[model samples]
Target: MDEVEVVVAHSQRATLRVGEVFLKVDVDPAHADVEVRAMAMVPVPTPAVLWCEPPVLAIAAVPGTALGVLGAPSPASPAAWAAAGAAIRRLHDAPLPPWPGRKLDDVAEELDRECAWLLANDVLPAEVVRRNREIAEAVLRPWTPAFIHGDLQITHVFVDDEDRVTGIIDWSEAAPGDAMFDLAILTLGHEEHLDDLLVGYGDADRDVIRAWWSLRSLTASHWLIEHGFDPDEPGCEFDVLRARMPDS
Candidate 1:
């Protein structure tokens, strides 16, 4: 019998690994549907779907280790990061998904609500929240939308020993959105690798990427806490906010 390894679990979803296969269980079947559709459409490497039955989607594990995890140093080489960036570039160049992404006004409204919640809850210093919120405003402007892995966290990217990208996982959040937003998510809390990534992704607006870092961190902190994740961990969202402080 294969031993079960719990990858992640929250009220909304959970992932478990059993040897070479991963089983993702979601509260909403629509999320699995989106993942299946998005994976099939992407130009980059992705895990193979073995089967899907409502809330449970089974996939064969891809080769290579994850690019990195939040709150920890990544052992992947600069070339590996660059390769991941190139893969992302390919995805961005692909045709937009049929569905529409969040409107800019919706994003701004959500940011406002989240910021207000952060302030009302006293999750961080008011100054930290204020500064990051100010920084977050830069990403609120309009831009050409591209197919984006909406939750392109570092852990979603995989690379092999020779510094080549192997696969990207977790497509539930994939959609049409700001390309810089995906870049920002990929480098969140690992800002040192941004230059290496840009080597493969081509030039982009660094300020907008930075703005997304702030916006994403601010909007995500509350949900992370509620989901039983610790965003305050070193090199994580809280630190990302603190680093934006003038004195830091």
Candidate 2:
């Protein structure tokens, strides 16, 4: 029997790796449904769906290693980052997902709610949170939707030794939404590589990308903390929020 290694365990879901198979067990069957369908629709390389039984979805492991880890310098080459950008462009150009993602108004409302929670709990300095909220306003406007990987973190993208993107994982949040949201999430903590990623992605609104940095960091901190992860790591979520301060 293969050893079942726990990849992540949280209230909403848990992921386990048993040899070359990754099993994702989600509390929401809808999430599993979305992931399975999104993987099929995406033109880029993705893990093969082996099977799905209710809460558990089994997928073949992707080849190569992740492009980078959150809050850490990416060891991947510039070519790899460009490849990731090109892959994202392909996804965005694909047909819209069957379902829609959060509306801009909904995102703004959630940001407001989360910001209030952050302030009430003192998770972040009030001024820091406030300033970022102001900056985040830039992303609240209507966007021509695209197929977006709602959680396009650096760790989600896998690259080959030759600096080519082999696959991208975690499609639960995949839906039709702002393309810049994916771009912003991919470059979250690794702002220095924005230019390289943009070279392949082509034109993008830099301001909106920056806004998403703040919006994502603000909304994700509480969830991360609840899920047994620290958002305050030097270059992690909280730091991403702090980095937006005018004089940080």
Best by TM-score: 1
TM-score, prediction 1: 0.99
What TM-score would every model get versus the actual structure?
0.99, 0.98
The digit string of per-residue lDDT tens for model 2 on 134-201 reads 99999989899899988898999999999888899999999999999999999999999999998888
* lDDT values, one for every candidate: 0.94, 0.93
Colliding residue pairs in candidate 1: none
In terms of lDDT, which candidate is strongest? 1
Worst 10 residues of 1 by lDDT: 76-85
Q: Any runs in candidate 2 off by more than 4 Å, and if so which?
A: none
